[model samples]
Target: MEEVEVVVAHSERATLRVGEVFLKVDADQSRIDVEVEAMSLAPVPTPKVLWRKPPVLAIAALPGATLGRLGGPSTGSPAAWAAAGAAIRKLHDAPLPPRTGRAGRSIVALAAELDAECEALVANGVLPGDLVTRNRQVAEAALRPWTPVFTHGDLQIAHVFVDAGEVTGIIDWSEAGRGDALYDLATFTLGHEEHLDDVIGGYGTDLDLDLDVIHGWWSLRSLLAVRWLIEHGFDPFAPGCEVDVLRARM
Candidate 1:
């Protein structure tokens, strides 16, 4: 019998692993379309799409261990992180996909949303008012203009697979789209700030990125994610978690 393992289950979506196949179910069909198209368009290695039917998309699981877990230090070597960086650069440098991706949210448009989220966090006591305020201020730097690039929208550490110091594959492309290039960099390096240099080293010196904007994204992303995580039964307040990331900015 093939045992079905729940990779993650939340209100918006769920991912199940049965043997070597991963089944993703989502209420939103458009998001699934984005995932399929992004996987097909990305220049970097991605899981093979076994099949797709409406709410269900099945993909063969890629080999090797994840780069790291959220809220934890990554065990991936500097070489592996560099390889991941190189892969991201390739994706960013690739020609834009024929269709726009889901990450089309503009920073200017997100300001109101970020303000509301921060206020809710303060009112709900999800984080210290001062901490939230400071981080919100820092996050403003990321609201400036940026040239859109092909981005993996949700480039969490765990989504990147590495084996023997090489990035074997990158999974989860639902948010892939034309967006700020630094946003991908920020998302990839979220809790793993210590390895930023290694990633940049592998990315090379061709492009000049603003470190302040990157730092701003760290604050912004951590702040906006807290309330949503709580509503979805996640504990972002745990040690070394999103709350800690915000507090670190103080």
Candidate 2:
């Protein structure tokens, strides 16, 4: 008998794996809708959808292992990271999706949210005031204007699959849509700062991508994520995780 695997479970959604098929159960049908649509539209490789039944979306497992998770060692080679970067650039250059993605927040909205979260973090004693203040300063650069592009808003390393130093697939498109291109780049390189050059190499230098903006996204994402991750029973303070990412900026 094939053993079922509990991939992830939290308040908003849960994912399970049964042999070769992975089933994602989300409370929001709209997110599933976006995932299905974005996969069809994305130019790069994505998981093949097997079926969908309201809350449960079944997809075939991809051929390779993920690049790695946050707070963990990344197994992908320099070539693999670059390949992932190249794929992301292709997605960014694609036509825009109709809806706002996870990374699509306007500067005003994002700044407001960041401010609120920072206050809460300090008030609740979740993080030191100095840490939050410094990161907040670093995050300011990302609040500027940006042209929207197709983005896999939550492009974590673990979501990218690779084999033989090549990108095989990208998964978890629930956050995909029109958004800032730098947001995707920042998300992909968040905890793996050492690999930034490899990704940039694959992504190209002609685009004039700003390193400061990417770093700003890193701080912004870490600050905004700490609360939700805590609520979701995840430890943001884990080594090489969100808190550490912020601490490095200090």
Candidate 3:
């Protein structure tokens, strides 16, 4: 391992080395740095949400190679999905700090938030086809009584890292929140249909995931992706064809 001193302070963003490892540095007083070993696989990039942090100053240790590759999904396969699901279940079972504040009164409030996000997308000249309406209905329905569990908020193949068919760790915890457990299921299913059964099976009845709730989360996530694309100058309509198809079904 090579040790280097910080000449200039950058940001607290995580950096990765392609097919190697990931390094996350904190800008706080301690200047804590975390390094996670990368599994020997990559995931396919689908529409997914990721947390954002400050930038990092890149110091090249190896010649002609970048520090890490930003964006994109892991090489999530059936085994990888199974591993990810297992990891997720373990995380859910772990103790979490108590949640505070009235984030939402009920499903209605959650639905309202989804609606507002969709409306804002449209108002900003981004046409998400029928994703907004579809998501609203799903959100309202999913708000019914269900076991509340910790959610990665953006749980998807992209956010998952795998090596040797085992999930080493999960990345991008910025959107971590408390919500319906099904939300994570939805995210996994929508992006990794082939591994849907495996992921659900891994959940192992610890929590009952309603199909409606999963569908609702799928719609909400799709809309969020489209909105992001629009804002970032990516062709939302073209890249979000799957979301459009789901909207049509709705």
lDDT of each: 0.88, 0.94, 0.50
| Candidates in descending lDDT order | 2, 1, 3
lDDT of 2 by residue, 54-119 (tens): 899999999989888999998888999999989999999998988889889888999999999999
Candidate 3 lDDT by residue in tens digits, 57-160: 22222212111111323355566567667777765564442441122135666667667877887686565535456566665655677555555555655556
The superposed Cα distance between candidate 3 and the true structure at residue 105, in angstroms, equals 9.2
Q: Evaluated with TM-score, which candidate comes out highest?
A: 2
* lDDT top scorer: 2
Reference-based lDDT, residue 52, model 3: 26
Ten residues in sequence with the least summed lDDT for candidate 1: 98-107
RMSDs, each prediction?
1.2, 0.7, 8.7
Candidates in order, TM-scores: namely: 0.96, 0.99, 0.63
TM-score between candidate 1 and the true structure:
0.96
Q: Candidate 2: lDDT over CA atoms?
A: 0.94
Question: Judged by TM-score relative to the true structure, which candidate is superior, 1 or 3?
Answer: 1
Which runs of model 3 end up more than 4 angstroms from their true locations? 1-75, 98-108, 121-125, 128-131, 233-235, 238-245, 248-250
lDDT for model 1, please: 0.88
RMSD of 1: 1.2
lDDT of 1 by residue, 99-127 (tens): 65544577666899899999998898778
Q: Where does candidate 3 clash, by residue pair?
A: 16-68, 39-163, 42-74, 42-75, 43-73, 43-74, 43-75, 73-158
lDDT of 2 at 165: 77
